[model samples]
Target chain A: MRALVVEDYHPLRAAIAQALRGEGFAVDESGDGEEGAWFARGTPFDIIILDLGLPKLDGLEVLRQMRARGDQAHVLIVTARDRVEDRCAGLDAGADDYLVKPFAVPELLSRVRALLRRAYARKDPVLRIADLAIDTATHRVQRGSQDIELSQREYTLLEFLALRAGELVTREDIRSHLYDFRSESGSNVIDVYIGYLRKKIERDDLPRLLTTRRGHGYILGPA
Target chain B: MRSLRWRIALAGGALAALMVLAGGAGLAFYLQHTGEQRLRVLAASQLQALAHGLEFEHGGIELHSLPESGLGWALYKHDGSLLAGSAWPGMAPPGSKLAAPAVTRITTPEGQAGMLASGWFQPDEDDRTGGGEISASLVFSTADIDREQTGLLLSCLAVSVLTASLAALLLAAVLRHMLRPHTDLAEKIAALEPQCRGQRISTATLPAELVPVAERINGLCDRLEQSYQLAATFHAAAAHELRNPLAGLRATIEVAAGPGGDPASALATCHQIVRRMEARVANLLLAARLDAGQVEVRRDEVDVNDLLVQAWEAQATRAADRGLEALWDLQGSGIASADPEAVRMLLANLIDNAISHADRPGAVRLQATTTDSWVTVEITNPSSLDGERAARLVERGRRGASTSSDARHAGLGMGVCCGLAELLKGRFSVSADGRELRAVLTLPEAAEFTYW
Candidate 1:
């Protein structure tokens, strides 16, 4: 998954982006509301963290523009404005969730998790494809009662593919979800990470679950 | 019904009563004098009538004016002997010789108080009395004079009391009518709120007599409104100031303690925020001291050149980071009897402001000049602000830009520098011509004194 953080305070923005990246979500960042709004229009993000006290434009204005443009990314309000009225206004302004500042990192992460879950309509944190199992909560994979370890990049590729196990996810879709605004990735890196994921999860003894369709995209299923 | 109204009425009633009483006394005195003169003249006329009716040739000089009007008359010689007498019922003639025309209080036959007159009057050459005296003294009782005087005085007092009461009532009514505006003004004042911008004492609608009072009240309210606005602004600014660093602090702690966070970066942020907060708190303390009027001026010999170098060194990195060059043209080594801390703060503030607003790759120039009487320091930087902004830059909470979005000094540097300069007997000024902003601090040179 990919998430964007739009906050003015540098340390807070950096910390949120770092925590999201640690959680296997590629995070794009904007230091101000204007840039944040522009990023929202240009990028396809699954979730967005917004701060109200942003320079150039307000977070609410950015949210308004995003909604006006029909961008359906789950927006979580992370602001210093803790007033109940501000919370109500943010929610009314199409905010998916509201989190006041000085919030615990785990709480923010859980809220983001909840929002993403609601967005994708995935009730379970663990995805299953026949004999292969991937816990989306902790990025742990197991196949036929055998625990498997994967690198951060390889694990992200697997999670993205497993979330849409029955459907075909194109290379562009995989690339958009794998890398953030800060990182520009070519097609070869995605293919290389998919190769690494195949080696780890698709054992010769078991039925191959992670497979690729010719001239289409990669899919995670027993095919 | 108010005490003020009652007091006014009481004062008016007292003055009115005094005036009425004085007028009544004057009228009574004049009436009494006129009555006494009329009685004296009537007495003389009666004496003449008595002399005219006297028949001295027979029956021992009959007095035709006696028993005629209840007037008692007697003709006495020089030895107190009655030459001729005519007495009314129970009326007695005086047995003393008459010296001159005299009017005295005497008792009539009815025991009533009356005016009596006795004098020597020339009678007709015909038979008047048995004596060959050149003048026959006549005495007569005054009739009805006392009753008439008492009646006149009583009437004057009655009219005075009635008129005074009416005048007092009229005065009370007029006073009530005249003070209506004052009462209305009081009500308006009672409803006024000094903090409200709309509430004001209506000087234009007030009476002319109290226009000045209303104007003063309005002026006081205006001052109060201004102070209230300033206090509100200060309160908001203080909150923002506190919240800014608090946000940074919380974020730093969260970032350091959170998973996959960089401790080094958080440590740096914490240090930076701590330093900025300390500076802000110190400035607030100084402002409090300034407000309390407890600023003690230190008479210390300060090296301006050293202070300037330190301030320049502190700001040079920021200037260079923004691709700006900080250049110092040290014309002279300025020295003065100044507070070292104040001088250092002033230099730091000026240089920091210059560096913060300097265009990227532009030049920030500092110049110091010392004369026999003054030590001047000037710092100039490329700026986009107009001359008007530069002029008011020294005002508290005033910044180079119109908005608070700029991350420069947070609007606490130049204003405090100006205040400190003033406390050190220095003149601080800013000059901007759109292209360049220059701040000048001209401080008086103190006499060299070594008490250490």
Candidate 2:
């Protein structure tokens, strides 16, 4: 649910960061290859969008180092250099996907959604538990033939938990995925958002899919 | 209508023909004159011999005719009466007086040409058989000699024509062989591309004399290839430069115009993108002009200290806005013979680079020095750039590792600085350590000073 964008162009980098943040994946971005690589190596980001021509170090070198350290974050290459050889070199160095610049933000969001599904080992775009169905692509949710609507933050919280259903997720993990570097650590924001999501998805007639594990964190689905 | 080769051959043949005719004509004339002289001498001696036999016997000259050696002879008295002789028809009218000896060509009655010698001969006036002077003439037919001379002339003409024809053929072949290199060279030149990138014509197989032409062509090819490469690099660099701003402009518009965006922030972003594009375009245009030698520098007396202070003011404002410290050390005031606007431009680029690359909150420093004949300016900034990275900063479109600012559209300041320094007839260089990057500009001191 967390993403990293490693682009150097200010306007494009900012735009991509905003788009990813808008898509409900907590986004962190850097304008240099060295910093990007450092962040990728240390963080448990689910995906990374990398630009090859980066300052301080090349993007390929960053990918190489990250992979050498066995950091398995799925990386997507986004660059203006669309030449065949440049694409090949970026991919060969361990990029999971490649996108040229001036890309449609919608397409980029869809690709991220697909990658996130793959990470969760879900072949279907819709994550389902019993009678509840959540369309990951469209951000629509339904429970036992009843439609459910939720706020952006509430939806992001529900999806994160649903993707990792049957397991416990820590507060720190939720905080990291739901916020950016510039956001203040308010500590109570995640629980408040969780309460909002619970109200919308839990119906009286539907089997309980959202749960809390005492003394630890939260879990979703059958357990 | 003749080709060049044929014309040459014809000229050669004509010269040969003229030489042969002149030589043959002279020889024929001399031979004919000698033959006539011999005929005349025979006639004169015969008359003398007949006179020697005369002793006034029978009151007139009588002599052994010597059986007429293909010559006819006659003697006439002063009264125009023939004394003793035989006459031939058409032999110079008999009454014609022969006062002195002469030889001439005459036509015999048979219409064939003959040589006649006429004279009054008086025998040596002593010794046996004293003879008296008498007017006489001798006529000898020249039919055989004339025929022979004509034959010689005809042979000369034949030989001349034949030799000229042969020489003409030889000359044409030799000319074609000699000029073969020209054709070969033309074909090679024709095959060459105007922007000929790599291929070069082989000069080794050319004739030695035409080797220089081929070499010159190869040299021209080298220039064309270099020009082509320059154009290509310029084009790619221009595109690389334009692509970033274009992406920025498009993405910013898209983000701001979307339903979830705010118009106020979008307006601000649009303004920033426009400003960035304007600055980039100006820098690229200047770089292009400088490279093409289209920029002209107007030299005037410029106060180095003032220029330094002005540049520092602009850069300091930018640094302060970013929460960084800027320091200036001005010393050794002097003058430089350079364009004021150009110097301002150079300083702006250098100071801008320093401020942008300086560590997020680190200090930037500017220093100036003036020696007896040189003026130097330097800027140092705390940075992550090392010697290797610093060395490449001046390359077109090469950005360094500082993210305090957008480096994706970086290296323009470095390019502008380096190019301006060259135009000012100065040297620009960079040095960096682990913690600091330094740029230096050293210029020649101006002699004239105008106080303001």
Q: Is the docking of candidate 1 incorrect, acceptable, medium or high quality?
A: acceptable
Candidate 2, A1-223: lDDT as tens digits:
7899998776788887877777777889997888998888777899998887776787888899998999888888877676688789888988888887767777777788888888889899998987778898888988878889888778888888888887899898888777767777576787778777777777575566778876688989864
Clashing residue pairs in candidate 1 (N, C-alpha, C atoms within 3 angstroms):
B323-B361
TM-score of chain B of 2: 0.74
lDDT of each: 0.74, 0.74
Candidate 2 segments whose C-alpha is farther than 4 A from its true place: A42-47, A63-150, A153-223, B1-89, B93-151, B169-192, B196-226, B299-323, B332-338, B359-361, B369-375, B395-412, B443-452
lDDT per residue (tens digit) for residues B291-334 in model 1: 44577788677778778988888756657766787677876557
